[model samples]
Target: MSSSASTTSTRTARPVHTTPIQQPPSDSTSRIPVTPAVLRSIFASSRTPHEERSISRIAFFRFAGFLLSCVGISLAASRGRGIKTGAALLGVV
Candidate 1:
């Protein structure tokens, strides 16, 4: 019983050793270079209700202009018949 007790005491007294995990060095080539303009575009503040509404309005207008341009180009290329086909293709896309 004393031998078992001594073994238990020695086991409890021993300090545990551990090595900290090391992180891999980051490669410069893997990182994308972000310009201030790109950062501003990505993280633009739209906290206010007015700013949110304005941003939404701007997006809508931009999309409408793009659609109109596509339709205009399609109509010019194929002369009116292509509008339906183009619209169908756009819908599919």
Candidate 2:
């Protein structure tokens, strides 16, 4: 019996050369200090009238939801016992 074998050759990869990136110089004088007054001015000056109204409306709705949750919790507690017990729990009684 006769057997046949095949031979294969592999090539090694070469490393690529790249140039280093250059960054712009930063000036300390150009940077602004974040004080409370600067932040307040930034936030106060950037808001439009519509944005102000939207913010107020959102605050009102959040307060209303909080009140509604309190009432619902009181009602659920009272349902298990009595209205006086629920009011006592909420410090109203």
Worst 10 residues of 1 by lDDT: 1-10
**Model 2: CA > 4 A from native:** 1-42, 83-93
TM-score of 2: 0.42
For candidate 2, what is the lDDT? Answer: 0.84
lDDT of 2 by residue, 17-68 (tens): 5766676458778768889989877886889989978887998999999999
- The TM-score that candidate 1 achieves is 0.37
RMSD in angstroms between candidate 2 and the native structure over all alpha carbons: 9.7
Q: How does each model score on TM-score?
A: 0.37, 0.42
Show pairs that collide, candidate 2. none
